[model samples]
Target: MVKAAFKVRHITQRYLRPPGALKEKDFIGRCIRCNQCAEICPNNCIKFFGSENGADSMGTPYITPREKACILCMKCGDVCPTGAIKPIKRELEPIVQYVEMGKARVDEQLCLSYQGKSCGVCYRACPLADTAIKVGYMEQPTVLDACVGCGLCERSCIQIPQAIKVIPNHLLASQLKATHLKERRSGDNDVQIIKFK
Candidate 1:
């Protein structure tokens, strides 16, 4: 079991996961999931959880904006002595250099555009120097195929609420799913739906 755990950690690290592939940034991203960011959050936006996902990031933590968007509040950043989550002026900087997040996806079924109305707020809001998100004539207006799931659409949606969001990579999310199945068979007990607590 120890060897198996080591292998999982080694593989996850091998992937050079998180904080992007930029080596310079990874230096600041060696987070041990200490929950400092979550704890310091006044808005209770940052959240973490035990690894029901896999041995790799088992007990690993992630931040879900839905708990509360960063607001660029800087509480997490100020408390992050290790610089795990950087702080920046919400208006002046990109906040999260979005491209580093991952490729974006537009679920047509859930998207307002696909909801039979021509709402193109996302395209207009997306910062378009090398626009990762854009609009195209898809017989129905659809987000450009080049979208990098950066949550911009979700953040900028004006449909009385958000209509888009950044999402974890489909392949990675599936692998975690498989890990869950494996864990269930091992009978370590209790499966609970994790919430953003």
Candidate 2:
């Protein structure tokens, strides 16, 4: 498992797996490289990794939000024969609670709203709307912790460099693990060790 994790850590691109995807190592191990998830996608958002992403990642389904964003139809999970992508119900509450594809982050410097242009495209595109993201003065997007990172906001952003982007969950998980380890080493014995099963 540790060796698998080391390999997973090397695929450094900020790409998201399908909704309800397992942890990186487990996903790679469990996924049979079948393209069923992509076939059933109503939005046609799912794409497969080529040789560039590595052999372990070859044919693995991923979504590039900038090009096309998932509609959260939950069909990908339903078609996954392997549990790499666990089946999630096509319900709002279940989707919010279970999906951890990533979290949306806004780049204020590149945002039109921050520049007083009153762009609310991202806010209007969000499926979760006010729950996952809130718009304040000038409709500047404020990402909440509840954001499941479905990538619609990033896709809808009209900025040249994209004012909003989804930071993949694997990257976030790695950062969290590093922080916990650092805290543990710095005599913070109170820090709990989170096991990624």
Candidate 3:
């Protein structure tokens, strides 16, 4: 019975760790699992909870875009005084995009665009101008097609912490297609729509 219990414990540890956490452990040996990352996140992207997975994953920081997304604000990683959520230096890679947490999505219901509000915070803050995020709509601002995943909108969002977030590109494609389909259903007339603001 003692031997069997020990074997079960060993197997449990082997399988319970998260794949996302492997890189973190490879570099740091083990995380302190401090809540600092969650506290400092500008977009409140960090989630720490316990589950059937294991104790290690429990209360450990991970980002979920459906809940919140990393803004490339780097606050969580940077504040990791322990270097767990490490940042790869742009100087070292040279050509990499720095941080690609994911693509940005506007929840029209949660967005000011649907409300006809006059907030250009996201459009104006975007570094790539129209190439990154553009403001559409006749009077209200909506995002036009060209988004480079730069994350300035995620940063500038005034929602406590922030409403906009960076998500992985894999998830965005299907969501983007669906959003476009909804626009088509509404007869938005993309051909004649000209957005300057």
TM-score of each model, paired residue for residue? 0.48, 0.86, 0.41
Can you tell me which runs of candidate 2 are displaced by over 4 Å?
Answer: 1-6, 9-11, 177-197
lDDT of 2 at 37: 97
User: What is candidate 1's lDDT per residue for 59-119, written digit by digit as tens?
Assistant: 3444453333333344555565565545434332353453243344455666676777777
RMSD of 2: 5.0
Residue-level lDDT tens digits of model 2 in 51-112: 65666777899999999998899998999999899999988788899999999888878999
Supply candidate 2's per-residue lDDT for 95: 88
**Best lDDT among the predictions, by candidate number:** 2
Best candidate, TM-score? 2
Q: Where does candidate 1 have its weakest 10-residue lDDT segment? A: 13-22
Ranking by TM-score: 2, 1, 3
State candidate 3's TM-score: 0.41
Please identify which of the two predictions, 1 or 2, would achieve the higher lDDT against the true structure. 2
Count steric clashes of candidate 3: 2
Lowest lDDT sum, 10 consecutive residues, model 3, at 10-19
- Writing each residue's lDDT as its tens digit, candidate 3 over 1-197 gives 44442232212221111112234234225567778877886656666655433444455665544344344454555566566656443231321244433445565555665567767676676654565465666323344344434455766776555545544443344456666787788877563322212
How many Å off is the CA of 99 in candidate 1?
7.5
